[model samples]
Target: MVGAWIWNRNKERVETCSAKAVVLATGGAAKVYQYTTNPDVSSGDGIAMAWRAGCRVANLEFNQFHPTALYHPQARNFLLTEALRGEGAHLKRPDGTRFMPDFDERGELAPRDIVARAIDHEMKRLGVDCMFLDISHKPEAFVRQHFPMIYEKLLGLGIDLTKDPVPVVPAAHYTCGGVMVDDNGRTDVDGLYAIGEVSYTGLHGANRMASNSLLECLVYGWSAAEDITRRLPLAQKVATLPAWDESQVEIPDELVEIPDELVVIQHNWHELRLLMWDYVGLCAPPAGWSAPCGALPCSNRSWMSITPASASRIICWNCAIWCRWRSLSYAARCCVRRAAVCIIPSTIRSRCLTAARRYSRPWLT
Candidate 1:
């Protein structure tokens, strides 16, 4: 909100897509984990922005954790896609022991929830930093062909997929829960829509079935398109939105604390990340899981005025607060965060999609 105007935003507006529509292509709640494949800018900002504007949000929990993200101390963020397992892969213990069997009968072939929870359980029991995924038993050609991206990145990081096991662990990766929407991407409110990872369509069930993430996007985006095109003909033209406000506020005019120190920002950011990973992870809500573990944000500006001399100090403080909040925002859905899974079987899929479809579209519009 503090930067919404600077970011070319404040309130949302209706839009004309190829015809008339919008899709909140915001990805998943993965960054809530310490290790993830999502770009750093992701923070469930789209979801919150939508909700604050009056869209009904849903199933804010039920995040999906990936079972095999690369876990070397130097390579924790790179995801080893399930496609690797689809081709041929094994989850091995730190000591070169194959342990997936003890967790699930299907082993690497089990659905993501089962596999990720298994990895989490193993990591805890073995007291190891992370487990490993081995594709080394496969021929070099096969390994290279199916996972060229993984192969190249690992090779650069000094781990060869054809010879050594890749360090792997479960990282929060997807939100099986999200603002509820329909197959048509309609939420409770009219003229709104949602799609992609942020919307929970029933197809994923309690745990996501493999390869359905992208498929859901395509399927429902099409549905949203049809619904929107049909509505455009009947939609009315509205008046222009108001210009931004500045008559009451002035730019800062000083520079006492603008050295641009990012250390505090980064440290708090990482701390918020690990908090989420440790608190809410795989196997769905394990006993006493809260919404997400994260830090509250505060800046010196909260204690000072936005003036020229104070601006620099405020900016630095603002940056630090933002760094903290953005990471925490990843796991925060709509409210202050209910801190519970809180989904009923009969309502799980429908309510989430309903919330997403009827309301989430306005964020990007």
Candidate 2:
């Protein structure tokens, strides 16, 4: 919490910043999953930094998967918001039969967790890639008027939102757990505050309701600001903070060598994403949880073996991803242990096992 060593992208060098208080608003880690509605920048950097700074992160196992994202190949991460369902869209199978009623009485209007589980269950049971969301029964004018941007986006993607049932699937939407923070957004580390999706304020619990994320951010952002202002007057100022030193850092002689290293890093990134999605994803069963938890330590060791003083920005990012990945694996293991102790009901456990059995492929093992 003393200061930060920042990579100055514009200057192509490292810079140092000393601050009395630091706030992390760096979104969530949805990009850790293969399929997510989050932008590429949501790579869990803030959470990783906080953890590295000795802040305790909690409940990372409760990643909320939104029930419906556009399932087209070109726009796989594009989110089709829940408003469609709120407006009376139906969740249907390939044969155009409704299925949500069988899972929950609220049907398409069920809570996000329930709806996502239902969609995931059906996709596995039918051995299909995706389900359908049909708002075609609603008038074209109504659809266009209410969802103009969605209508336009779908049109460009070659699907008529009003005339056709949009292909949909669950996608990693939000991180409900993060660095544990107090009501004033203070972390375990003094002088550092985490706000927005980066901090776990125990507001969302195991399931985050839609639109509540914004409220958490607004409330915490203001509170953190107020706390920082109150504390800033009494904060001790560092007389002389050391600047970033690259004295012993090794740089590759040949520019050509950098590409090879980058390729390896990219490959590692892909592997990590796939590992998370397959092993620790929505329906992760307790039986196979060890694989991902074990895999991360090797990756962590490998990354650490390479001296970070010589590491490139991408390598540093990959290291951060590994840090978050380890936390995620730990969270998943904790969740499994809790389930074993009967924290989760037998009915829910049975449903999760069924989904896991259906979805897991031989190659995934």
Candidate 3:
């Protein structure tokens, strides 16, 4: 059941070690946000690939926002871990006044959902781009002892954690929703498996508690491995598959200078991030989902017209939007069903799921 697939960066071919049981451990889809603590590669590739392969995804709406990402133009989503807050770091306004206590009695130690929402609220209310995390009151020896990594990294970035108030903002951190998998890490697609942040295993309900993701990933990885081992003895072997089709794929007449097209792609990515950051991040209401959902098809059509090399990037962005919409609708539906009196009704979720499925059909098939 062990397998691997590596797509040639310069060519459109994917080299597979074996395809008997595909284990997709590609991590979360947090890069869809403008500001995310996720690694740059966390674009929901596993989730999108699963959906394309016809597996259902669930609970996409519950993206966990980390309350403190260092807000520096050069830092680029460097995370200031929750342990800083856990150790009595103060979340403060730009004017050096503390704010978290006003939002929650637990102050800096409140759950991520509440802290993220509070920071987001404060940022909006104060018309500020970023808030501050102050742990400067701690002894420098203690700071360096506890957070050697963050301290050194911040120091390298010219911000001393021992002296400076770290400029921070809430950023998309973890995806609580993903391709639905059973306890054995099995998806709807037979012989296909998902684990890590890519699979929704009912461990993280609405919000993911701290440090549980790594634990869940380790547990599920072992489970999937065990399940595959048991089935390996009876596994069906297949002949070598056909090569990739380039018939419908049009190679450009030349590597045409399409900086404008590339610029458009950049603009599209920027716009997508803006829509999510403004509407979907931290606090999502029904009204916020409208603009992005409405724009998806048009943006997708534009992206589809690009050259094949660029089309790959386009497809990634398109799939990100599609999955986000599905997650939002799914969560909205569950919320409405439970309460039965919310602005986002269950029907909205049903329609969103149906439409997203229909929309993705052509892309993967």
Error of 2 at 77 (Å): 1.9
Q: 226-247, model 2: which lDDT tens digit per residue?
A: 9999999898885455887766
Q: Give the residue spans of candidate 3 off by over 4 A.
A: 1-5, 10-13, 16-18, 250-259, 296-299, 302-365
In order of TM-score, best first, we have 2, 3, 1
Select the stronger candidate by lDDT from 1 and 3: 3
Candidate 1 per-residue lDDT over residues 31-95, each given as its tens digit: 65577767655566556545644666665555656778777676456678888888778888878
TM-scores of the candidates are 0.70, 0.80, 0.78
For TM-score, candidate 1 versus 2, the one ahead is: 2
Question: Global lDDT of each model?
Answer: 0.60, 0.73, 0.69
Give the C-alpha lDDT of model 3: 0.69
Give the per-residue Cα lDDT of candidate 1 at 166: 84
Query: What clash count goes with each model?
Result: 25, 0, 0
Q: Find the candidate with the highest TM-score and give its number.
A: 2
C-alpha-based local distance difference test score of model 2: 0.73
lDDT of 1 at 296: 28
